[model samples]
Target chain A: MFEIFGIPSNALFGQLLIGLINGSFYALLSLGLAVIFGMLNIINFSHGAQYMMGAFAAYLMLKYSGLGYWPALIIAPLLVGITGVIVERLFLQWLYKLDHLYGLLLTFGLALIIEGVARNQLGSAGLPYVVPDELRGGQNLGFMFLPNYRAWVIVASLTICIATWFIIERTRLGAYLRAATENPALVRAFGINVPRIITLTYGFGVALAAFAGVMAAPIYNVSPQMGSELIIVVFAVVVIGGMGSILGAIVTGFGLGVVEGLTKVFFPEASNTVIFVIMAIVLLVRPAGLFGRRA
Target chain B: MEQRVAEPIATPEVQPTVWRTQSATILFVVMVVGLIVAPFFTYPLFLMQAMCFALFACAFNLLIGYVGLLSFGHALYFGWASYLSAYSAKAWGFTPELAILTGTATGAVLGLLAGSLAIRRQGIYFAMITLALAQMMFFFALQAKFTGGEDGIQAVPRGHLFGLIDLSKEMNMYIVVLVIFLAGFLFIYRIIHSPFGEVLKAIRENETRAISLGYKTDRYKLVAFVLSATLAGAAGGTKAIVLQLASLTDVNWPMSGEVVLMTLVGGLGTIFGPVLGSFIILVMQYKLAAVGEWVLVIQGVIFVACVLLFRRGIVGELANKLKIRL
Candidate 1:
């Protein structure tokens, strides 16, 4: 029953929780983007489409294959990641030597195709995605009631992001990836099979997005457009965080989400543009981004 | 491919002129004559729609073609201006010309802001930034009461032009649109040929080199952006008058994508590419409206094909084959 800033604590905490949940998604998606950018030197514009595919794949699995959320969580990412691999091999590999802009354009075209097909098949309406019975309810967390599904998303995304960081920063395979990113030719000289590694890295990044999509399906609507809108915000998050550092991406994603959530609670009119306002400020203050390395 | 870049010109050949120029001139003449004669064949409303989009694409081409900046958020200006003009004409009951001027000025200001913010980044970042900014505008349009929510500002009046010409008449409106397109097209042609346009190309080719050479590249970019945006607003304002309505569809991201597809299909960095692209795409859409999302898929395919094998575009490719810079 306590109040803060003339608003109930319960309402404030609830929005904060929602903000954190959204942040987890931002962190996960941006993290994937950074990893892919590190290796490919291309921003994957189809990331959102692949994410949509992830949710749709999960929806289809449940509808026909009789699989539950538990299995689809693993299966969806795998299928989508394989699709990424195929795309990389068939189309993206050709652009390695071209202008980075071409890569962006090609991926954009692919995204349009994927999204268009989904829209045609599914129509524009959102389909219901029920949370797993195990994760269905809420917990009274002293000051606020927290939805278990949302809590699971936050925890799971945080765990995945940290694990990815640890793997990249603290392991041998991570060392190879970091080294390859620094100099692929040099890495290949050491018998690292750089091209295959690059393909796999793309696949892994897409897989990360798919995982987030699967996680988001139950919370958000399973629709064709679910990712298209979300991806732009993630792009802004990447810009603010600086694609140069993974940890920076993770932190900025969560921080911005909380800022956005707090804005919704205090000044709902500016809630939609709060992140953009921050981005404009960031650009003015530090064009290189918060964590970008100055060339 | 690498060898093609290595081949040097032993002798500078005179740039050959081709039929594209003649054909384009002929087409322009035909289009003008057709517009003058269009009332007899097509509905005035349909011709107005085509002219509006054609002008929009032409304006859009100024930036992407000559300047090499692919702005994905131009729909923001187009949509915003449509709203402003619609509001001015309908709510305040201003003359059509005055309302259009108001919309154009709004577009110039928006262009100035967005261009300044977006020019900081280059290449893909630039595209993404513009896209994000446009999305921000979209959200603003959605929340703002003036846009009339989902319904948009309905029944916007086609007020008299200059308090003399009645734009409510189908024949009168067609002439206004045709004149506007001609003026806008000539204005773009003038800009491209001016020394200012040369600076834009230099900046596009190599910004650092241009900066090092002591050209104020950012100012030139801003000017180009403003011009492009203001013209797009003119197109949007004209559209509002023709349709007698303004809606959210004008400012949405898909509208943004639609313009990009137009420029790509017509030709990037070419004078008349967008005009050609706009007509081709509009005709296709009209025919395939019932094909559902396949239009999007087909558009995507064209985008990919253009970027990969047809980067020069229809006009650009023809110009290249004939050794002309048309």
Candidate 2:
């Protein structure tokens, strides 16, 4: 019954909800990137692929093991996190001494390998993960119908993002991470096992990505190419947010998502490119990023 | 610290002798001769494709190798040029040479715009900025009607070169591509050896030092970026004529990644590295065509190997270990 600028309120609310959901994923992923970059000084190009792996991990859990969604959520991230630890130990360790570019290239290669292997084993057609019975229904809010699963995804991702923030910004372990990121040699001199911390931090960052992946599986198609498609936009978010602050990553991710959703309503043609256009403008205005310290 | 100090001293002494080596001269001649004669034995289309990609990679190498600036969005220039050249030749009915020139000019203008914006950031941020800008271009290409959307500009006419020589013939097209490749290659080589290149190299080696030493480092970087972009566009334009199409594949992020991969596999800083890298990658793609998606896996494996163990690349490692310039 209500309309703003001649557009129905339901359609607007619906897009905003979708935008918020997309933003939740962006926040989760970019947060993971910022955390990883904090310690490793490497942009994990495979974050998207790892996210996809998280989804597939859930898919495999259900298809072969007959485990339900809840258990898979717990198990998938751990499995993917373990793989992340292996990747860090086996390959990424050597690149820390080289230019940061090598880290980008190396991770890019890993992403290709993961995506390629997945594509080879499971074809490109996206497989749907069924929404669990408990979260299957929707509620009529008078203005719009809100799906329970969608609301759950928003809540779960927000909780995880906040929890991650609390751990890094408030906890003792977070203090060690912040200290080590500032001066690894000094932290090593302080008798902390910095390498182990580095390894675990990478795993934790990747686990965050995996968690987001599991959340995304029910909404988006579980496809091999899924990660590559989303990772670039996340990179833009990281750029815009200025990987210097964790909270920045969270705010920018969700904010950009809503902006993108709004674009779809007003100028549908520019929705795909609006973030990138904003990125250029931000670079022009503040090259250090909104939250980043000058490099 | 001592070993690090010794490296700079050792490099200058060895550089001149390596550049003038008898084998290096022979290698150059042999390569030229091989290029001139290869079309007779090999498929011209395949050769043309290799040459186009080789030129593209070389153009990419100019920035990363000499300028120490990695651009991840080179596909914007390459892909945009292909689209423009294809459109001009087909829609506007221009000659092949004019169409390619038009594409190159477009690439230069884009380079100026993107280069000015991207160079504001350094290292990792620079790479991301270029990539983001390129993605913007990709989205534009996807939506713009002139690019023909997903179908791309197909069946682009291989118009006559200069309105004199017919380019529809395979041999004619091959010759034109070869000429373009050689010109681009030799031009890059010449630039590298020039005094301007020396300044660019200095900037790459140490930007603060170069700036402190009174060099207008940003301007030099922008010029190099534009030049590199222009050549990449020229290559893409030439390829459009050869393939008679300009598609989204040329402008997408994957193509940008592929060029970076080629540069890495061949050798990042070496002159001939990209050429060898392109051949190796293209050959692998051809041989592994039946294997479907495994090619990406193999390429990824090569990337890991190159980063971890073979950072110097094939040409770079050989040049280092053998004490000979490639």
Candidate 3:
């Protein structure tokens, strides 16, 4: 019965929870994008399609193989990551030496093909993905009722994101990645197989997207079009964060997601466009983005 | 490395030989003649649609080819202009000519706004910013009252041109659309050949060098952006009148992608490439209508193929092989 700013506190907290959850996906996806872009200099326009594939992979696994959610989480990303590896070997490898825009175009083509195939097989109408039985219940947090699945999504994504950050920013392997990103020739001179590393880095970035996708399947409808819908907003997030620092991408993703949730509370009409509006404003003020170094 | 080798082949031939000029003139004459007689054999509406898309693709090419800036959200100008022209013709009862002008003006204004912000970034960031802004505009059109939400503005009247010739007839409408397309196409050609266009090309080639030459490169890019947007709007307005409807499909991201595809398939920088590209794509879409969603998959395949094997595009490759400035 308590109210804050003329709206129920429960509603506000609930929206914030939803926003946080959405932000988790944004962080995970953008993290993947930033990591790939750092090493490959390509924006991975198919990131969205890959995310959609992860969800669908889970859906198909459940439908055909009777795989449960727990196992699908591990298997779906592996499957999607292998697909990413094939895509890199077949199409994207040729584009590495070309203008970076070519990579964007190539990936965009991949996205269109993937989405079209999915749409052909499964219509546009969304298919429901049931929350796992263990995560079905909710917790009374006094201020708001938190669904266990939502809590798990937030916690699990944050853990994955942080672990990714630590691996890239704090470990020996991370140093190799940073070194390769900065000077691949130098890294190759050090007897590291940079091309192989590049290929694996791309696959890993794609796996991150798939991981987020599997997490999202339970929350959102498992639909072919879901990734495209979210990817543009994530692109805006990337622009706002400036594809520079890994931590920057993660922070910006979560921040913007919360802001979007707040907008739904105060001005619902602008919810769809608020991120873009912020991107325009950011471009006007700091063209390099909040955490990005000047290009 | 491959791109470096392909660059010399794809660059426009510097020496405008007599043979090249003669071929170009012959091509133009043939195109005009084809436009005049083809309507008799083919459906005028279909031809008109192709012409409109051709203009749109040309406008898009002006930015990507000449200015070296790829705008992924050109549908904002095209779709926004379509809506304005449709609304003016329907509600304000303006003449078709006036309505089209209004649409072009709207595009110019929107271009000024979007280009200023977009020009702040370079390369991939610029493309992404433009696309995000266009997505914002899409949301606006979706919620705005005048756009009529999902149904869009329907039955937009094709009023008399100059308040004289009736455009309700298919022949009259086709002529008006053709004339508009040709004028816009010629104007773009003139822009490319002008001193101003040379500066744009220079900036595209090397921004640092252009700035060192004391040229205000930003102003030049902005101007080119506005010009391209206005022409795109002209195409959109004409299509609105021809089709008698302005829908969300016009403003969506897919439409923007289609324009990019048309330019890429035809020839990114070639004068006549977009026209050919538009026709080929439209005909493909028409023929592939029965295949349902496979059309998208096919378009995707073409995109991949174009990027991988035919980077110079259909006409671009032919021009390179023949050593012509087509």
Task: For model 3, state the Cα shift of residue B319 in Å.
Answer: 0.2
| Residue-level lDDT tens digits of model 2 in A1-295 | 5898888888888889999999999999999999998999899999999999999999999999999899989999999999999999999988787777888899999999999999999999999999988999999998888999999999999999999999999999999999999999999999999999999999999999999999899999999999997999999998999999989999999999999999988888898998998998998899899999998
Candidate 1 at A265: error in angstroms? 1.0
Candidate 2 segments exceeding 4 Å error: B1-24
Q: For residues B1-326, could you state the per-residue lDDT of candidate 2 as single tens digits?
A: 01010012113235555444655566667778998999889888998999999999999999998888889999999999999999999999989999999889888999999999999888888888898899899999998999999999999989788898998898888888988998999999899989999998888777888999999999999999999999999989988889999999999999999999999998887888899899889989999999999999999999999888887788887777766666
Under the 3 Å rule for N, CA and C atoms, how many clashes does model 1 have? Answer: 1
Proportion of true contacts reproduced by candidate 2: 0.76
List of chain B TM-scores, one per candidate: 0.91, 0.94, 0.96
Give the lDDT of residue A238 in candidate 1: 86
Please identify which of the two predictions, 1 or 3, would achieve the higher DockQ against the true structure. Answer: 3
In model 1, where do residues sit more than 4 Å from their true spots?
B1-40
Expressed as tens digits, the lDDT of each residue in A208-266 for candidate 1 is 99999999999899998898888889988987888999899999999999999999899
Ranking by lDDT: 3, 2, 1
Cα displacement (Å) at residue A262, model 3: 0.5
Each candidate's DockQ? 0.56, 0.60, 0.65
**How close is each model in CA RMSD to the real structure?**
2.8, 2.3, 1.7
TM-score of each: 0.94, 0.97, 0.98
User: For candidate 2, what is the total of clashing residue pairs?
Assistant: 0
